[model samples]
Target: MQDKQLNKDEIAQLTEADWKQRLTSDEYHVMREKGTERPFTGVYNDIDDKGVYRCKGCGASLFNSDNKFDAGCGWPSFDQGVDNAAIDEHVDDSLGMRRTEVTCSNCGAHLGHVFPDGPRETTGMRYCINSVSIDLDKNEH
Candidate 1:
């Protein structure tokens, strides 16, 4: 979590070797390769910690624990995000399945998918996210 993406000028100034030194293996894979971690397999999958979940790639606040829900799916699911601007939704037809892919708006890093099957009283939106793609900020108060 200590390692954050710098501005364009800062990152642009760094060589390939420098970038490698600044990032962890997982961060490099998810951020640079746009790959996904296995479902129900992330460290935060079972986390009961209280905090805001931010995009690991850009440190943008994405979700709050209060909004998280049990989707019975392998990944972490949320009924709501911090705000509309915190995430972006795109139409994804990859893998022959039509779905909306959600990404971190701040850095355009893929977090996971969105489904219309959410609580009826809620937004009817399910943000299925990858745990490794996020970093939690525990509240001290």
Candidate 2:
């Protein structure tokens, strides 16, 4: 099922406490605190199912199953988001490394990092996402 995207007003109205209550501890850590789940430990790491992955924090559609691919990176990798508007990217200088951080466009929740070393056949971008940061809605068709 496709989720309704939340407006900025709705996203801004949600306090930290509300977010804490809405998301699990792990989800909160990864999505709200910009934490990364251990490699190979994420639920979606090896999933090849057909679905749309949405932000766990706000349920915003972020990635389509068609874009997902196994990069052997121990995380759920995708070539791109559902669209350009579904995610926001920023320069991350944390952990002594520079990376492009991907976030939910609606709520500014961290999703993961994107790398340039992806399949050359596709967009050449690898969206290395944390499983706790997203929920997948399996396509029934």
Candidate 3:
């Protein structure tokens, strides 16, 4: 894993070839091609480890494990991202449905989608993320 966080400037300079070289087939599919992963198959789906989930494409911190929750939606869900700047949401009108697509702000890598149906006590937002688009940086403390 990259110990240093990648900045947006560095990410912007990366091309498709660089992305392909940096990410695996599965990662490139989800993070680069904006494809979804099979539900309940992501490595982080059931994990409750404490740490930050960094973008697989740019090593930028996107989600904190403390915000993660089991939405039972097959993918790893989070109430929110690390902060407002960590992720960017866009309108996705694919599959004849209107949804909010989430992407890493640093690298513009597709992480997943956001839904209004989540824990009501919290943000009431479920950030359904693809595991292949992230890497867990477990907290040592």
Candidate 4:
């Protein structure tokens, strides 16, 4: 298990082979290649556990269970990240559609996309993250 997040310098020093060796095929596809898992097929989709979601690539704290909600969009949905620095958003124009892509700030791993169609009572933003991009660190509260 990863105990610490990688710094920018460390992240920059990693090679493609280093990433492939660190992650499984699926994780590499989704995180390194900017691929997306099938909707409703993600392990974290239905899980409602109390924990922190850390970046699978660098173990950077990304999301809290407190910000999680059932967006019914198939992936694990969070209203917000753990902090502003934990996630970085970029303009994704792939798939012929304009969308905002979210990545782990610590390692530049592709997490998923964020949309505006979230619960209005909260942040009104849906962080549709891929299950393979994160690992849950369950904590008892």
Q: Per model, state how many residue pairs clash.
A: 0, 0, 0, 0
Output the lDDT of residue 38, model 2: 99
Reference-based TM-score of each model: 0.82, 0.93, 0.96, 0.95
Q: Compose the digit string of candidate 4's lDDT tens values, residues 1-141.
A: 367778888889999999999999999999999999999999999999998999999988999999999988899999999999999999999989999999998899999999999889999999999999999999522
What tens-digit string does per-residue lDDT give for candidate 1 at 45-128? 778678989877656788998878777887888998899888989998988989998987766667888999977788888898
In model 4, what is the error at residue 83, expressed in angstroms?
Answer: 0.9
Q: Show where candidate 4 strays beyond 4 Å.
A: none
Candidate 1 achieves a global lDDT of: 0.77
Task: Report the error of model 4 at residue 55, Å.
Answer: 0.2
Candidate 3: segments with Cα more than 4 A from true spot:
none
Model 2 is weakest, by summed lDDT over 10 consecutive residues, at 1-10
lDDT of each: 0.77, 0.89, 0.91, 0.93
Q: Weakest 10 consecutive residues, lDDT, candidate 3?
A: 1-10
Model 1: ten consecutive residues of lowest lDDT:
2-11
Task: Give me the runs in candidate 1 sitting further than 4 Å from their true place.
Answer: 2-22
lDDT of 4 at 15: 98
